[model samples]
Target: MATFAMTRERIFRELVERSNRSGNAIWLARMIASWRVGEGALPDYLGLSPEQFNNLRSHCFSDIALPHLAVSGKTVDYSRMLEKQDLETLLGDFRAPDVAETEWIIAILVAGCLGSDHLWQDLGLWSRSELSGLMSHNFPELAARNNKDMKWKKFLYKQLCEMEGLNLCRAPSCQVCQDYGLCFASEESTSVIDQVERNFNRDA
Candidate 1:
């Protein structure tokens, strides 16, 4: 498994390097290469319309293809994020001052909000640090506010909760909360990106 892990890691690095390696390309490549959205069509999982997906595919993954994408139609509808429009607006407001196409990223992150795992895992991003990098790149102000390094999903929802003047978690003080681990715990031992690389090497 260790040997295969290295192979997977090398394969992933090569794929990113082979591509343009722009921040957008790297993020898209990580998600696409991860292949972890086991239950939905790629575009829907990525919170993108078919047109948007196609454009990104052409620009970022032109040299790589996946069977998952060929499975057409929306397997799951993440459109109704349960009254989370305010959250979307907040994300947009903090988007990087100099970047383009961040709205697409905001849409993707909003779609990811509907998942049960960590936000990065839900987005098939492979690692928490990668998610952090993306956030720092595109939502620097908001990301900077996460001084305690709270989990991205928890942090985002917490931010949303605070923005709406609600304390849904009911933990006015996190230090005393029983679910502190849920907010600040470390990720699992294996990077899901390894799984993505395995799948990419096997199927792409």
Candidate 2:
């Protein structure tokens, strides 16, 4: 497994890099990074008071979603995607035994920020192997059965979008927008387009 310094900035940056490559995952990743890089209480990022945050966490962790993750032969449920309890446990599961308490908790909060959305279907926030790698690295026993699943991430993203009142739909004009290419461009193409736009604007 690859090991690196687990600084908040590092984790935030890692998620951001993931976002750059992810189609719809960009929004949640940006929100999570903003929360981490900002100077505020944890609840502030989610618009919850400390007490409410605690309450939510308590409610969530008490009954984890997808308890089948730890058991064998239990079928995974995709229909019940956006339960608050499941969303909470999505973050809670990141608190692996090997992770530092602070980092682990931050990981959970990051997951929370990711929340439920249909965009997740187009832009997978994390793939099955990525999740398996993370779990296997931190909690090997959980990886023994190796059921790599990421549908829960989509559910979590949907929930987050609902909580924030975010509209995840692409605009009808998105396909025709000049800036749409920025989202789909390769690094080199993006750079060339940036230069061209700068020159065009300068001449105008």
Candidate 3:
């Protein structure tokens, strides 16, 4: 497992260095590198279709070919279920007016939300701050609405709930919410390898 992880890490470094054509190169590299390698494929886990992955590949790693990666059965057909029509509409409505050709980033983000981790970790971003950078640049309107610095995942769901007229949050306001920590806790993440090391040590 360690050896396999090292090879994936190598792939990440190479991709990060070579990916320069778009603003999302490092994002893609982190996601591809940190992806699981069992029972699923790369595109399956990232919530991208085979063609979408290929398009992203052409944009980021045009001359490179990634190894066949396996993903878990959990993510099979995930994009269809997670990519809800209303959710996409919500994100689409807030698409940065100044940024051109940002639909793909929205697709990636919607798919990424299906994961069980913090939004940034699920998207294979290095940290919450990195995810914030993407959001601020690509969906500045939505980003600006998060005046409380709430966790991205929490903020997104809150937005969705409000849009759909669903009062999911129990608190009257975020500041007084019983689940305040869950929504506003500090989010610090590291490289994929470093994350594994931390988990390994914790379990040791």
lDDT of each: 0.69, 0.37, 0.70
What's each prediction's TM-score? 0.75, 0.27, 0.79
Query: In candidate 1, which residue ranges exceed 4 Å CA deviation?
Result: 1-15, 36-45, 62-74, 193-204
Q: How accurate is candidate 1 locally (lDDT)?
A: 0.69
Alpha-carbon RMSD of each model: 5.1, 15.9, 3.6
Q: Higher lDDT: candidate 2 or 3? A: 3
Q: How many clashes show up per model? A: 0, 11, 4
Q: What is the overall TM-score of model 3 with all chains considered together?
A: 0.79
- In model 1, pairs of residues that clash are none
Residue 107, candidate 3: Cα error in Å is 2.4
Misplaced by over 4 Å in model 2 are 1-31, 34-95, 102-114, 118-130, 148-204
Q: Tens-digit lDDT track for model 1 on 42-137? A: 344366766766666566656755343422244446456564677788898899867765767887777677766678877767678988999999
Q: What lDDT is obtained when candidate 2 is compared to the true structure?
A: 0.37
